[model samples]
Structure formats: C-alpha cells, structure tokens
Target: MIPFLSAWPPSPANPTLPADELHVWVASLNRSQTQLNQFWQHLSEDERARANRFYFDHDREHYIVARGLLRQLLGNYLQLPAHLIAFAYGEHGKPELAAEQATSGVRFNISHAQGVALLAFSRNREVGVDIEQVRPLDDGEQIAERFFSENEVAVFTAVPPEQKPQAFFNCWTRKEAFIKVIGEGLSCPLDSFDVTLKPGEPADLLQVKGSREAAARWRLENLEPANGYAGAVIAEGREWQLRTWQWPA
Candidate 1:
C-alpha cells in the first residue's frame, strides 16, 4: 500500500514536499506510441475503429495508459481488485464510481493535459481535478471580462501581460475543479466564484456565492503542474490530506 503519513507537509508557509513525495507523475504520451499501438492491436477491429472515431490517437493512448496507471495505484493503495473498481458518470460527464462503490469509501479524480495526466485519490472524501496547458491568448482580458466576476476581472487585469496566461489558466482550472467536485458542471455560473492562485502558492478560496453549504463543505487546491501547465483539485470535507504520487514509466 502507498505510505500514509500522520500529517501533511505543513501549509503554504512551510516548504512543499520533496518532488518524489508530491505523488505527481508525468508521462510523455509521445514515448508511449509503441505500447499504445500494441494495445490497439489487441482490441477487436470494431473496438479499434470505435476508439479511432471517438478519440485522437494521443487522447486514446492517454486514456488507455492513464486508466492502467490509476488501477495500479488504486490497487497498491486500497488492496482492491482493479477490475472490480467500476465507474459511473455524473450528469455532466464527470466519471465516478457507482453509489455502492462510492459509499464503500474510495474516491479519486483524474485530469490530463498535453502529454501528461494526473490522478488523485482519497479514501474518505469526494475529489475532483482539472489540468490545462498554458497557451498564448489573444484576448484574455476580454474573455475574463466576459466570464469572470468583477473581483476576478480586477485580479486578472492587474496581472502583468507576460503572466496573464498562467493567471487565466490557474483561475480556469480552479473553477473547473470546484464545479467538478459538485458534479454541477455549467449549471454553476463561472462568474459566481473566485479563487486566489498566486504563483508558487496553494490555492485559496476567495469567494463563493450560490451554495452556502457547498462553500463551507469543500476544500480546493491549486497545483503547479510542471512549468507549462495549471491544475487544481477540490475535495469535500476539511480533515483529509493530499498526497501526490508519481508513476514509473
């Protein structure tokens, strides 16, 4: 089983954990081309064609590899058979285990960007995660003005031009993570909440207006995914700890 520590590595004021203990893994989907092709070869012709139709080669490869890694990590940590870990989807396409499995108490969230994917697991809390690549933006300010709350727009407008993309992505991921946590999708207005995501810092909940119960019940974390990506995770409850793990290629 994965090691469980008595306490998490302090807080933002304290140093982050060693890279290894952060439980962050990175895979170069580019490097997995051969393994992906082999996986395809094993599938029936119809299944292969279905994958081709539903996903790009890279996304298909990512799904296959990520699911395998999630199973491996879950099995190692929970001692549960990987095959028995059934999956169900939320109204918004957020994938989760069935009520029976969920009540039995395993929770996880997964997100992928570029060639890398992330998986987070917890035994006693609801979790959700999102990752996005930092891309050049032609009109980030306009987009923020259109979709962000007044306070969020103020924060975005104040960021230096060079830092705007990262700031934008950071906010986007945090919002997505929170939405996913509630399984509410776009039903939650993007402008109704605000998250603080300073560089090299943990995410802080700034403002949440609609559901008082939700705001009080969930904890959100912003992650620095490598150097070029922004990521976030939201977990229900306050007593849980986060432990990131890396996957061996």
Candidate 2:
C-alpha cells in the first residue's frame, strides 16, 4: 500500500526527481485568511484571475490554494521561486510548465474535489492524478452503464449496494486519470477502456479497447487521499516507484 508520509523535509531546497519514481502529494485546500493570503502570492496574474472566475467563495479559495500549492511544489522541484514558475495550456485546457521551465522533462497533473487536492510529478513521463470525495449519487448505476466499458458495467452491477459508491468512484477516478495521462479530456471515449473498480482489488487498466500494447504501456493504482475520498494515479510506464507525501507535513 502507498503511504502518505507526514514527515516534512528539513530544508526548502529542491527535492530530487528520479526518473524511475513518481511522487504524489495530498494537500488540504482549507486555510485561514492569513495563510491563504500567503499562498496567493505564489500565483501568476492569470491564475489569480482564473481563481476570481469561480462562482462560489469556497471554490474560489480552493482554486487559489490549489494553484498556489502547485506552483510552490513545482518550484521546489524546478529549483526556482514559486512566483517565477510559468504555465502553458494545452489544446484541452490541461496545464503544463512553460517550455523553458520544463527542460528537465518533468511532467505533472493535478486534480481536486471537496477541499482536497492530489498533485503528481514525474520526470520524463506523463502522469495523472485524480481525487474525489465519496458521496452517494442517485444515478450511480445509470452513470456506470452510460460511461463504463462493458466489462466495467458488468462488474459494477454486481457490486453490493452498500459498496456501489466506492466502486463508482474507483471507476470514475481511474478513467479520469487515464484521460489526464493522455491529455485528451472527455473526447476520449470512456467505454473505449476498462479499469478495475471493486474495492480491495488492485487498480489496473485491464484493456484499452483495440490496443493491448497501449494497455501494457501504462500503470494505474488506487489512492486513498483521506477518509471520505477515493483517488487514482496513472503514469506512462510500469517501472517507476510511487511515493506519497502530505502537504504541510
């Protein structure tokens, strides 16, 4: 099992990013006004403007904190001041470090929900991370049938009623992590791939529809960010080791 360590590094220096290691961080988005103000300093003007576009105050605060923390974390890895980090957007609105800033080939992805965020980092490999709070959905099964692959729908249908929520999120998070890894967003057909959703089972991308080779090229794993949350992370290759860390540790 992956362990989210509570130990903070002693120094503010750049952390090593090994080619064969993937780092995942769990962060709490809730912060006091003073702390939130400090995090705000890490944002770019564009990011700050985007934060302001959120409809809810809580959402706006969370976006600010999440973006700020992302910059801070990338700065640590990139050995630059947080404010100096630059980001560029992909065609699908996915964010990546500006070309010059990413010479080391460091790639990352972020996902957050309900005041918690998951950030993933890797060197020279694509990575995606997703976290969602486990909540009851009235149309959970219908959603499964509509989006999950045929095999996934069958498995999800067989899950006990009390366990459906967990199974639904397991499938959702894994599928989302895959899309993020590919940077294709919703245009990637959900039913075109398959992922394991049963609780207590190992998370895996069992098939990628037509390409067995594509399915073998990536690795997927389950994440338990917090008590009421379900998460998953996928990376380009199966060789890297995963390390989990807690923010503000």
The digit string of per-residue lDDT tens for model 1 on 1-249 reads 122222323223222322122233344344456666544444444444656674466677766666655655555544566544556787888866675666646667777878777677666566778888888789877888888878888888888878888888988888888887778889989899878754555686666884556476777776654557788887767665556534434
What is the Cα-based lDDT of residue 147 in candidate 1? 80
The alpha-carbon lDDT assigned to residue 88 of candidate 2 equals 88
TM-score of candidate 2 relative to the true fold? 0.94
Which residues of candidate 1, in runs, are more than 4 Å off? 1-28, 31-34, 37-50, 210-214
Clashing residue pairs in candidate 1 (N, C-alpha, C atoms within 3 angstroms): 22-244, 23-244, 23-245
Lowest summed-lDDT stretch of 10 residues in model 1?
A: 1-10
Clashes in predicted model 2: 0
TM for candidate 1 is 0.77
